[model samples]
Target: MLGPAERAWCVVVPHQPRGARMARHRLSTELVGTIRPGLLADVVAVLAELVGNSVRHAAPLPGEVIRVAWRHRLDGDHDIVQVRVTDGGGGAVPRLRPTDLDSLDGRGLHIVAALATRWGSDRDGLGQSVWAEFRAPAARLPGPDGDDPAPNDLLATR
Candidate 1:
């Protein structure tokens, strides 16, 4: 469950080629001292892929900006991280493609799907948002009754 300590971080950048790099750097810096190393890598990779896709496909309108937001929280006993990238809508919706091994491109969503426990996108009047969620190893902590909760019990709380 998310507590008062769980706060999301967000940034908006110009919808340009360099925006993806900017978003990635911001995400890396925000996560540097907070998350575990292995999980951090996966989260960063997903951020890059999603941001790159937005830059490549969903080009923003003349004065529009891309929005990136991320948050880390404890859902029951699990540590969950969620990220969202939104851009102006003008391109085809993103989907997983069946690319051959020799293809030089079209693998970003596949990587995202593999790394993220769950991922999807939403579209509104402004644009579309691609979001992904990653779960890290749960930290064992004593429950209200002064005993650690079982894994199944923890899941049930969620």
Candidate 2:
């Protein structure tokens, strides 16, 4: 497993359907080897949903683009990943509302909520941002004596 490491990245893409694709690819590329495969996949999926929502429902920022950002850090042996997608403000805020069972649409926020440990939205002067945080594998594991792993373990599972 990888050692304790931290990184962040941001990219601005045109506010179009293709923007989500680009953001997903960038997220996967930046985080590929730094995290476990399953964790990376979940992060990428969350990024996709956030970007897709911005492109489909919100307007472009001042530059007619959407900003996708992510941060990866070790929080006391817990690996955490948070992704944010920013777009021009919309009349409605992003939130989890019950969807029709037979409906073919409006489940993006639901999927994000299911996979992310926490999620919410914030508004700025020019735009709004929707973000989610996920927890990666921790360093703690049963020791020879069935005790918690040492602090020096560093959660190195890479």
Candidate 3:
């Protein structure tokens, strides 16, 4: 677990399908010892969807690159993991689109919505950044009674 201060990890890769895979690898490696298995899986999936969207929708301009970053911080009792993927500008704004059962695509945002606690996207001067936040399961600690402390109690400590 990180201290009270925020800690971040990031990578920049060429805008391509392979770049998303590379970003996933880097994210997994960086978070190996820090994040729990289940939460790690969710985080990786979110990264993939965001990066894949950048590759498929926001084609990079000359000299542009896709950037993926994750930051960890303690918010009260919860450990908050925030991820952002930025790509070159000029793509359509990301939104949830209804898909038919016969459709083979268009589920990326759906998956992200299901997994992330909160998510949104914004346009910047250079490009758009899609961001998501997930609250990691709280760490178990012995309470005064020698049993696990309730979640509310943990927050009070903060």
What is the clash tally of candidate 2? 3
Candidate 3 or 2, higher TM-score: 2
Inter-residue clash pairs, candidate 2: 1-157, 1-158, 2-158
Give TM per candidate. 0.80, 0.83, 0.81
Model 3 misplaced stretches (Cα beyond 4 Å): 1-5, 61-64, 139-158
Off by over 4 Å in 1: 61-64, 139-158
lDDT of 2 at 27: 88
Candidate 1, residue 116: the lDDT equals 96
Q: What digit string (tens of lDDT, one per residue) describes model 1 on residues 30-149? A: 766455677888998998888888877887744767888999775655668899998886467778999999999999999999999999999977678999999877545456687976
Displacement of residue 28 (Cα, Å) in model 1 is 1.7
Query: Which is superior by lDDT, 1 or 2?
Result: 2
In candidate 3, what are the lDDT values of residues 1-158, reduced to their tens digit? 65544578877888988888998899888766455678888988999899889888886735767988899765666767899998875457889999999999999999999999999999777578999999976555566678976543543444
Ordered by lDDT, highest first, the candidates read 2, 3, 1
Best model number under lDDT:
2
Query: Which rank order by TM-score, best down to worst?
Result: 2, 3, 1
Top candidate on TM-score is: 2
Alpha-carbon RMSD, each predicted model: 5.5, 5.3, 4.9
For candidate 1, give the lDDT of residue 105: 95
